[model samples]
Target chain A: MKKHIRKTAVLSILTTVALVLSYVEAILPPIWAAVPGIKIGLPNIIIIFILYKTGLKDAITVSVIRLFLVALLFGNAMTLLYSAAGAILSIALMTLCKKINLFSMVGVSIVGGVAHNLGQILVAMAIFETSQIGYYMLVLAVTGTIAGVFVGIAASIILKRFEKIKI
Target chain B: MKNNNSQKNQKLRNDIILAVVIVFIAAAGLLLFVLTKQEGSTVAVKIDGVVTDTYPLSENREVSIKTGENDENINILTIKDGKASISEADCPDKICVETRAVSFVGETIVCLPHKIVIEITNEKTDDQIDVAV
Candidate 1:
């Protein structure tokens, strides 16, 4: 029982960290690169950590909680719906990739990033009531690929260090 | 030991396959962009959702549509007498702003959070105007 409680507590802390990082990223000025809608996806580090250390269920729980709390704090009610959709999609894709074990952490992370962006685009299309934005998907996919690889690499290093630690 | 080596070889082969797939997709996208390249002076801006205001671009009477609520405004800049290129959106990502002017048969400006999309058609051939909703 104590071990379970400890694990839950750790998960909560990680979720909080993810929420904070997401909020920070939201406030930062967007960096316009060759592709549009590209972001650093800083919160993904926490998600990847949870997936590696705990399990998929725990990681998903953390993602949902962090997304909800962040939306409540910084976004409108409608924005919550979009964010939730994107978060769920990203988590699902990453978990699936992890199950396959074909790609390393980096590969999984790239999949997650691409999935998240695509999910967001879908929601945007729904809201904007136009299909013209579909063109942007190509650019987004390319950008997501790059960002996913970077975040995945970062998470792998962190996970590797955590594994080596005796604590 | 033999099984472990074979497993490693399998993993390498899979990685190679995935890499090839990604490259192929990227190439396809680039090819599409190149093929669809258009040269026109017309610019049109579609204001997703509601159009709160229209601002003039330069002094030539070219107008840009500004959409969204007061809190989150997406401004599209249209050149060539209100035909293309919109900039300045209040969305966090600013992806729409980075998009170039749409001068081809099919081009669009999309604001996902606001449920807004601005699309350009051939104006001469396409008839149905349906918003994704």
Candidate 2:
């Protein structure tokens, strides 16, 4: 019972952290205005932390819930649709990488970020009904990889400190 | 302790391999993007999936697109110096306005809320740039 309680408490806190990071991201000015939809993906820190601490299923739960709640709070239907596709694909890729455990935290984060961009592009292609949209991701990949590094570093630091306090 | 060392070595190898792969992929994609780019001779303005106008990039002009029945959803497109960009947009994101001018074929600035698409096209032209070279 105590372990279960600890798990729930930690997950809830992680969820809140993810939610706040997302809100802060939305309010912050675009880091690169010329590139649309570019974000540092701060929420990925908590997602990665949860994945490391618990497992893939819990991490996915946290991501799906965070997406739904964020949509309700800050976005509309279109934003929701775009983010949902991105989040699902990103989580899936991260989970696969985590299962393999071949890469370090940074590499997993990079994979997640790149998958996120690819997923968003897929959604945009579907919405626009055109395949030429694939070209845009090429440009986006540069920044996405850079942002992934930032998120990976942040997650690495947090997870390290978090290890000292795991119940 | 030996097991831990091997695990660490494995992780190091994986990180190097993953980093190299991603960077290589990014470089390849960028190269393809640049190579495939063609100079656009015209800009096609589409509102709600219908082409409303095609303006020549060689011409300098400003077009105010009324995205809705009313004058509220307006996006001003500007063409100058052989490039096209959104000078103004009332959409909340202002994403269209933020995109820099595009003069390459297949480049687009889309405002999803307004259902506005500004695409650069390599339309057949009789211009000297195309004929001289």
Candidate 3:
């Protein structure tokens, strides 16, 4: 029971950290003016960390909670829809990549990042009922891969440091 | 220790392969778009997956598209000099407004928050082209 409580506490703290990171990214100026919706996906660092350190179930639970909370605090229904879709797709891909284990944490993170962007684009195409918007995916794929590398490196570093401490 | 070292090297190779594949696909898709693109003469405004209005690119006009409850959401589309753009919008993210004016076929200005899209199309008929000539 105590171990379970500790696990829950750690997950909650991680969720809060992810939420704060989302707020920080929101306050920061656009990384690139040419791409209006392009983001570094700071919260992804936490998600990747959880995926590597904890189990997939914990990672998913924390991700969902963070998504809902961030939407409530900083976004609306429309944002939630896009985010939920992206999060689901990203997590699923990350899990599959990790299961294969042919690549490192960075590889899994990259898969997650690229999948997240693809999910948003797919949702956009569905909503607009036009395949023309798929053109944006070219730009998104480049950005997503770059951002994934950054997030992956950050997560791996954190995981290494936490290896000494038992959670 | 040797096994671990080889595994790490293999993982690095795989990562490179994955990144290359993704980038290649994106580049190929972009090439396809470029090859098929043509100068468009019309802008189609789509709301909720339906084309609500169509405007000629040759004409200079401003269209205010009102949507949502009580028509609270507004996206002001401006067309001039054979290019279409969203000059103003009330959406949370003004991505559409920031997008460069589009004159080529398949170019789009999308306002996801407002469910609005401005797409360029080359739908001019032979008769219309002859008349212009």
Deviating ranges (above 4 Å) for candidate 1: A33-35, A164-167, B1-20, B37-77, B87-99, B111-115, B127-133
Residue-level lDDT of model 2, residues B1-133, one tens digit each, is 9999999788868876776777788789878888888898999987766778999999999999996777679899999999999999889989899888999988898888898888998667546668879
RMSD of 1: 5.3
* Pairs of residues at least 3 apart in sequence or in different chains that clash in candidate 2: none
Candidates in descending DockQ order:
3, 2, 1
Computed on C-alpha atoms, the DockQ of candidate 1 is: 0.32
TM-score of chain A of each: 0.92, 0.94, 0.96
Lowest summed lDDT over 10 consecutive residues: which window, candidate 2 chain A?
A127-136
Model 2 stretches with alpha carbons more than 4 Å out: A164-167, B48-50, B69-71, B125-133
Query: Against the true structure, what is every candidate's RMSD?
Result: 5.3, 3.5, 2.8
lDDT of each: 0.68, 0.85, 0.88
| Arranged by TM-score, best first | 3, 2, 1
For candidate 3, write residues A1-167 as lDDT tens digits.
99899988999999999999999988998877556557788899999999888879989999999999989999988888888989999999999999999988888888988889888888888888999888778888878888888898899999999998766
In the range A1-167, model 2's lDDT, one tens digit per residue, is 99989988889888999999999999998877766777888999888878887788898889988998999999988889999888889989988987887887888898888888889999888877556667768767767777887898889888888787864
lDDT of 2: 0.85
lDDT of 1 by residue, A48-163 (tens): 87888778888888888887798789987777877777788998988888898787777777778878888887877776655656666776777777777778878988888889
Using TM-score as the measure, which candidate wins?
A: 3
